[model samples]
Target: MTDSQSNLIDRYQQYRTRRFLANESQTSSWLPGWRTQKRRRILVGALLAIFVAMLAVGVTCHFGVEWAPLLWLPVCLVFMPVWVALRVASGRQDDAPEAVLDEFEIDQRNGARSIGFAVMQSLGLIAAFYLIFGAVITNGDNGDMVYAGGIFTLMAVLIGGCTPAMILAWTRPDPDVDDLS
Candidate 1:
């Protein structure tokens, strides 16, 4: 073939190849990574909020200010997972659109860390409580039933709040994929 004819054929082939690639990519069952991350964060946040709020309200009604010591349970249970999820979703990845993906990941990670830390702190408080009150609860001479009831109440509140938080922590990602920048 003549030089000009060969060049025209090559150009046509290149155009067809580009078009095919574009179409294939569009049809593929691949997720837009950023969008997927955002959706995940939303789901995690919603679950965390609902569960934490319920725990907090329940504990509040159960023990009033006596349960105040365990206030951190609600904070930790809700905050940590949400923070981690946000951090993972807010990374500076290729698929993340500018302006939209701002400090979202950072906030999410912070939330997760906050909640995780809170949960840990709450556990510490519970342990301390059990240690301090073990004597009173075990006393055979306890004629004051009210004091005993209060101690048992605290224990119950701690267990109620901590169990769900522990579950949430377990389900949450360790490093939070959203924060991968």
Candidate 2:
């Protein structure tokens, strides 16, 4: 990369690091009572269920169910922000740069990321197979299938991106009462 490109990338990383750190520091006030493992697990489950619903809506819309998009819009707008909050509440352990994390944290983050990557690869392969076989099955009249494929790909991306944070949130212990105070 050119100097300017490298500098831009570095700046963006710094910004992201700062943002995550800020979130960590302010999480209690911003997302009160969400520090519990049980609540976080619920949030993760809800997010996954929403993603599945989104995929269903996308398929339904492809089949001429026109009102599905109306349901999708509000859900997307609301839940996506919740996903961000979940990442923040989870301490951004999966995303914080290595320098910001301790050895144990780094190992945990890496393991979660590894699992997320594997999930992504598997889902991506499924999406690819769907597109290819779908086109063949339709004798190349695959316009609707393309839309479905796109939605499936997007669902894959969302699930894969969130997996690490979800894993961390679900597995992490509740904050110590002393620590909360």
Query: Could you estimate the TM-score for every candidate?
Result: 0.25, 0.82
Off by over 4 Å in 1: 1-35, 64-118, 121-181
Computed on alpha carbons, the lDDT of every model, listed in order, comes to 0.47, 0.81
Give the number of the best model, judged by lDDT: 2
Error of 1 at 49 (Å): 0.9
Q: Worst 10-residue stretch by lDDT in candidate 1?
A: 90-99
Tens-place lDDT per residue, model 2, 44-79, is 988988887888877886675656657677768867
What is the lDDT for 112 in model 1? Answer: 51
Candidate 2 accuracy as TM-score: 0.82
